[model samples]
Target: MTPKLVAGIEPPYYTAVFTSVRPDAPEGYAETSVRMQEIVREVPGFLGYESARTPGGIGITVAYFRDLEALDKWRLDTEHQAAKRYGREHWYDSYSVHIGKVERSYGFERE
Candidate 1:
């Protein structure tokens, strides 16, 4: 299945592609994730995201933003920092973050 796209965003935006493997006992993971989602939405220039996970526990979330500065702000936010630390210490077995510029995009829908 395809990951759902964040709707209504124009092209030429930035995307942060986050992929991770979940740890066995992820205490507080869900709460932190929900809080981070809420926090990012309140950040200026924040767009939206698409997320999915495989049955084996690999997950991916692609978050879009208006520009590098907005992405940077989100990255540097204090709450985000805490979340990252928590992930490193408790939740993620391995992960990767890829930031890229989206110059153009197109899609189709079948009803």
Candidate 2:
């Protein structure tokens, strides 16, 4: 079974969406990714995160934060900086990051 990569977050929050193409050789990608996940949880204002990937090597990760300040801090984290460097050097072929404020959101779930 596949996991759900969508987080349940409240409004008046910030979202960081990262879209990227997989690297040809992901040597330490998995380990680094797990480490980053753990690190983010410890950061203040971190709400949640979700991720998904396609068979074609394209992927997206969405992380929620209480505000832009928290998001900016996460972006400058030392460990995350290392990961970004690694990604540019060996992991990602291409990528883009977009941060936005979610003013209103609505959804439906049926049992």
Q: Every model's Cα RMSD, please?
A: 2.1, 1.8
lDDT score for candidate 1 against the true structure = 0.89
Report the lDDT tens digits of candidate 1 across residue range 1-111.
955667767878999999999954378888888999999999898999998888788999999999999999999999999899978988888999999999887787666
Query: lDDT of each structure?
Result: 0.89, 0.87
> Each candidate's TM vs. the true structure?
0.91, 0.90
The sequence of per-residue lDDT tens digits that candidate 2 reaches over residues 50-69 is: 88788889999999999988
Q: Could you tell me how far off, in angstroms, the CA of residue 15 lies in candidate 2 after the best superposition? A: 0.6
Best by TM-score: 1
Please list the residue runs of candidate 2 whose C-alpha ends up more than 4 Å from where it truly belongs after superposition: 1-8
**Lowest summed lDDT over 10 consecutive residues: which window, candidate 2?**
1-10
lDDT minimum window of 10 residues, candidate 1? 2-11
> What's the lDDT for candidate 2?
0.87
